[model samples]
Target chain A: GAGVSQSPRYKVAKRGQDVALRCDPISGHVSLFWYQQALGQGPEFLTYFQNEAQLDKSGLPSDRFFAERPEGSVSTLKIQRTQQEDSAVYLCASTVGLQETQYFGPGTRLLVL
Target chain B: EDKVVQSPLSLVVHEGDTVTLNCSYEVTNFRSLLWYKQEKKAPTFLFMLTSSGIEKKSGRLSSILDKKELFSILNITATQTGDSAIYLCAVERRTSGTYKYIFGTGTRLKVLA
Candidate 1:
C-alpha cells in the first residue's frame, strides 16, 4: 500500500468485551507507532516498534492495553474490558527509521458502550 | 516530564484570513519537531523542523522552529474552509538507541467560508 492501512474503520464494543485493532504499515518501513486520541484532543503516544521489536510501551495507559508486531509488518492493539473512557480513535503510523517522516493511516474509531 | 503545548486551543477564522498556531515544548533531548493536519480521518504530515530559524514552506503553509526558545509556529495564509482541522505538533527525542515522539494537546482551527 502507498500508505499505512488500518482495518475496521469503526468498531463498537460492550463494557466488558475485548477488541483488537489492526494496522498494516507502509511497505519497507522499519518503524511503526500507535497513538490514542480522544475527542477534541491530539493523538497521544501509545507504543513504538522497530521491526518486530517492541522498543517502547510506556505510553500504554494500562496493562489492559497490549500491542504486538511479531512479524515486523502487521501489528495489532488489543484492549481488555473496554470502558467508556477508552472510546477514542487509534492511529497507526510508519516511518523509514527512528528519525524520519511518519505516514499515518485513516485510524480506527472505537466506541465503548 | 516531557511535554508539548499548543496555544489558542481553538480558533475560528473567516476565509481569506491568516492565522498563526503556536507550539511550545520541553523535552530532555529534542531531535525534531513535526506538524500534522487532521481532517475527518487521519493526520497528514505537514512539516518537520530540525534546525532552528529555517522556514519550511508548502503551498500556503509555512512553519519555523526556534530551538533556543523551544517553540514552533505554523502560518497559514488566505485560509479556506478546507483548512479547518486540528493542527498537531509533536517533538521527537533520541534516547537509549531508540527514538520517541510525543504530541501536544493540539490547536483546533475552524475556518469559516
Candidate 2:
C-alpha cells in the first residue's frame, strides 16, 4: 500500500509571493492533517480535515494560511504573502480515524527569501 | 496552552548501547501519546500508546506510557547507526469536538557505528 505523498519536494519563493503545497493522502483515509516544521524543531499542527470537511484550522499561524480538501482525498496548503518566517517544511499526514496512528508524507520544503 | 517536552534535546550513543528517550506533556482532555522517528524527509510512526503501564515493542525498540504521570519513555536496545534520528513525541487532545496533536521539541539521537 502506498503511503502519503507530497508534490514539489522543494520550493523557493520571494517574500510577498504566494505558494501552494499539495498532499495526497493514503486511499480510504478519512482524516488529514498539515504541519509546519522549522529547523531543528518538531512539527507544529497547521490544520485538519475529515472527509472534505475542515474540522480545525486553529493551529494555522495567521490568516495568510489556507487549506482545503475538496474531494476528501487530496489537500492543498496555500500560504499568501510568504515571509521568511514561513520558511519551513510543510508536512502532511493521514489516518484511518480520529486519534488513530498517522502516516506522514515526505513533506515539501519551502524557502522564502 | 498544551505543551509537550522532551528531555536531553540531543544525545550521542555508540552501537550496541541502550538509550531511553523521555516525553512529558500537559494538555486538556488527553487522548493518546505517539512516537515518531524522523530522518531527513518524512517522519514515520513508531508507536501510539493510549493506555498506561502497557509496553509496546517492535524489534529493538520499545515504548511505555505512564498516563498518571503524563509522560512516556521510548527505549532502544542495542542501538545501531540506523537508529540515528530525531525522536518526536506527540500528545493528542480533543478540542471543540475535534482532535489536535501537540508535538515535543524532539530528542536527537546520534548512534555511532
Candidate 3:
C-alpha cells in the first residue's frame, strides 16, 4: 500500500512569499497531521485533521500557518509571508483512525531566503 | 507546556555492539508512546506502546515503556551500520475529540563498521 506522500520534495522561496505544501494520505485514512522539523531536532506538531474537519490547530506556530483537508482526502499546508525561521522540513502523517499508528511521508523541505 | 526529551543527543557505536536510547515525556492526558527511525527522509515506525512493563521486539530492535515513570527505552542489539540513524520518540495525548503528538529531540546513533 502507498504510504503518505508529499509533493515538491524541495522548495526555495524568498522571504515574505507564500508557499503551499501538499500531502496525499493513504486511501481511506481518517486522520492527518502536519509537523515541522528543524535540523538536528525532532518534528513538532503543527496541526491535525479528522476526516475533513480540523480538530487541532493549536500547534500551529502562528496565524501565517494554515492547513486544510477538503473532501476528507488530500491536504495542503500553506505558509503566508514565509520567514527564515520557517525554513525547515514539513512532514505529513496519516492514520486509519484515532490513536492509531501514524505513517509518515518523506516530507517537503522548504528554505526561505 | 508538553515536552519530550531524549538523552545522549548523539552516540557512536561499533557494529555488533548494543545500545540503548532513552525518552522521557511530560504531557496531559497521556495515551501512547512511539519510536521511529529516521534516515535521510521519512521516519519509519518501529513500535507503539500503550502499556507499561510490556516489551515490543522486532528483529534486532526492542522497546519497552514505563508509564509510571513517563519514560521509554529502545534497545538495538548487535547493531549494524544500517542501524545508524536518528531515533525519535513521540507521545500521544487526546484532547477534546482529537489527538496530538509531542516528539523528543531524538538521539542520533552512528554505528561504525
Off by over 4 Å in 3: none
Q: What ranking of all candidate models by TM-score puts the best one first?
A: 3, 2, 1
Chain B TM-scores of the candidates: 0.98, 0.98, 0.98
In the range B1-113, model 2's lDDT, one tens digit per residue, is 79999988999999999999999999999999999999988988999999999999999999999999999999999999999999999999987879989999899999998
What DockQ does each listed candidate score?
Answer: 0.86, 0.89, 0.93
Predicted candidate 1 versus true structure: per-residue lDDT over A1-113, tens digit per residue: 47899988999999989999999999999999999999888899999999999999999999899999999999999999999999999999999986899999999999999
lDDT tens digits, residues A9-67, model 3? 99999999999999999999999999999998899999999999999998899999999
The lDDT of each candidate is 0.94, 0.96, 0.95
Worst 10 residues of 3 chain B by lDDT: B94-103
Q: Write model 1 residue lDDT over B48-111, tens digit each, in one string.
A: 9999999999999999999999999999999999999999999999889878788998899999
Can you list the residue pairs that collide in candidate 1?
none
Chain A of candidate 2 gets a TM-score of: 0.98
Native interface contact recovery, model 1: 0.88
Q: What TM-score between 0 and 1 does chain B of candidate 3 receive? A: 0.98
Query: What is residue A102's positional error in candidate 2, in angstroms?
Result: 0.4
What is residue B60's positional error in candidate 1, in angstroms?
Answer: 1.1
Worst 10 residues of 2 chain A by lDDT: A94-103
Residue-pair clash count for candidate 1: 0
